[model samples]
Target: MALKETRRPSIFWLMAWVCFGLLGGSVKFRVAHPERIPERGAFVIAPNHYSEIDPVIVGMMLYRLGRIPRFLTKASLFKIPVVGWFLRRSGQVPVERAGSAAAKGPSPLAAAREIARAERIVVVYPEGTLTRDPDMWPMRGKNGAARIALEQGIPVIPVAHWGTQALMGRYAKKINLLRRHPIDFAIGKPVDLSEFEGKPIDQHLLADATEKIMGAITAELEKLRGDKAPAHRWDPSLHGQSETGRIEP
Candidate 1:
C-alpha cells in the first residue's frame, strides 16, 4: 500500500517531546522491524497493552518513524485539563464506553475509520486496556481492531512490547525509576486478513481475526522475552475480572 499524504498538527510534536522527556531518561527503548510500519498509509497499529506508559513508549516509536500516532482514547479523558487539550488538538479519537449516558457523540470506531481512511496510522490496544494476565502476556482482544481492518480493508500491524511493566506496574500509582529498564518493541508484518476481507463481518469472523492479531503479538513477545506464553490465553471473565481489563481483588 502506498503511504498517504497528511499533515500533522504542531500538537503532535508537542506531545512527542513531552513523552520523550518523560520516558527517555528512565528506560532504554528499542524498536525492531519499525520498517514494517507503513510510511504513508492508513493501517491499524495494534500493540499489547500492559502498562499506562505503553502509549507513551509506542507513541515515541511511531513519532520517530515519522508517523503521527493517533489513538482511540477514552472519551472521559478528553474532559481533563491539559491532557484533554493535548489529546484533542493532536487528533486523537475519543471512544465512549458501553452504556455510558455521557457518551453523546459519534462512535469512536467511526472516528477511527475516518482517521484510517485519511491514510494515517491509528494506534489501537486490541486488549482494550492493560493486560490482566498476571504474566503480562496479551489477553483475548476485543473485536474493534479486527472489525476496522475487515470493514475498512486496511492492514493491521501487530506490535509486541515488553519491559514497560517493569518501569511501571499495571495500575500502580507510582513509577519505579530506580533502574533503567529496556523497553523492547517487536513489530510484526501486517496480519493476513485478506481471506476475511470480503467476508461478512460477523461475531465468528471478528473473533477469528482478533485471535490472529493477538497471536502474532504473542509470538513476537515470546521472541522478545524468550519465554513461553500460557497454554491458553486468559479471559478476564473466567478469572473473575471485569471487561474493563481490571483484575478484581
Candidate 2:
C-alpha cells in the first residue's frame, strides 16, 4: 500500500528554515541512493548514530527526498518549553528510556504503532544513542527498531552518514562554520527479515535482526568512506562505558 503525500506541518517548515539557516550555506550535503527509501510505505528508518548534529543532517536528507521525518525522540526533551511544543506539533514521538520518570506512560512501541498507522517515516537511531566506538563505527544496537519491524511487518531501511562529527564534535557545544563540511548520506536497501517475521519475538530473534540492520548500515558507511569496518562491533557494557552518550577514555 502507498501512503498519500500530505503537506508538511507548519512546524516542519519552521524546522526546515532553522536547519537551512544553520547548515545550508556552511555544509555541503550529499545524499546517495535516496530512492532506496520507499516512495510510500510505513518503514523504520534505522541510521547509524555518530554526532549530535546527525539528526539534522539525516532529517534534511529525508526532506530532500520528499518525506516528512517523524523521529523517535527522548521523552525528557518533551518537557522543555519551545522545543517541546515544536516536537508535539511536528508529530515527533517521545520515547521514555528505562529509569526515566516519564517511562510510566505509553511504550515506544505504541508510538511506532501510531507511525505505522499513519504510514509515515519514523527515524530511529538503532544504536539508541551515539556510537561509543572509539573509531566512530556503529556499536551494538537496542532492540526497539527490530521489534517494531518484526511486529509490524515493515521494512527497516538502513542509512549511513559521514562528516557530521567533523562539523560538530560528539559532545562539543560549538559548531564549526568556518569551513564548509561535506556531509554524505547513503541509504541501503531494506533489511531482509522474512525468516524472522511471523515468529515469536524473543531476545535471540531481536538480536539477530539488529545485527543485520547494523551490519547493513556499516556496509553503506564503508562505501561512502571507502574503508572497511572493524571485524567486531563495540559493546559499551563490555567496555564499562555509559550507553547514553560518547565513552570518555
Task: Note the Cα lDDT for every prediction shown.
Answer: 0.85, 0.85
Instruction: List the lowest-lDDT window of 10 residues for candidate 1.
Output: 1-10
Question: How well is each residue in 22-130 modelled by candidate 2, as lDDT tens digits?
Answer: 8888898788986788888799999998788888888888876778889878888999999999899888988776775655866778888789878888888889888
What's model 1's TM-score?
Answer: 0.92
lDDT of 1 by residue, 81-103 (tens): 99899899888988777775436
Q: Give the CA lDDT, 0 to 100, for residue 201 in model 1.
A: 87
Candidate with the greatest lDDT versus the true structure: 2
Instruction: Name model 1 segments beyond 4 Å from true.
Output: 1-9
Please state every model's RMSD to the true fold in angstroms: 2.5, 2.3
Error of 2 at 211 (Å): 0.5
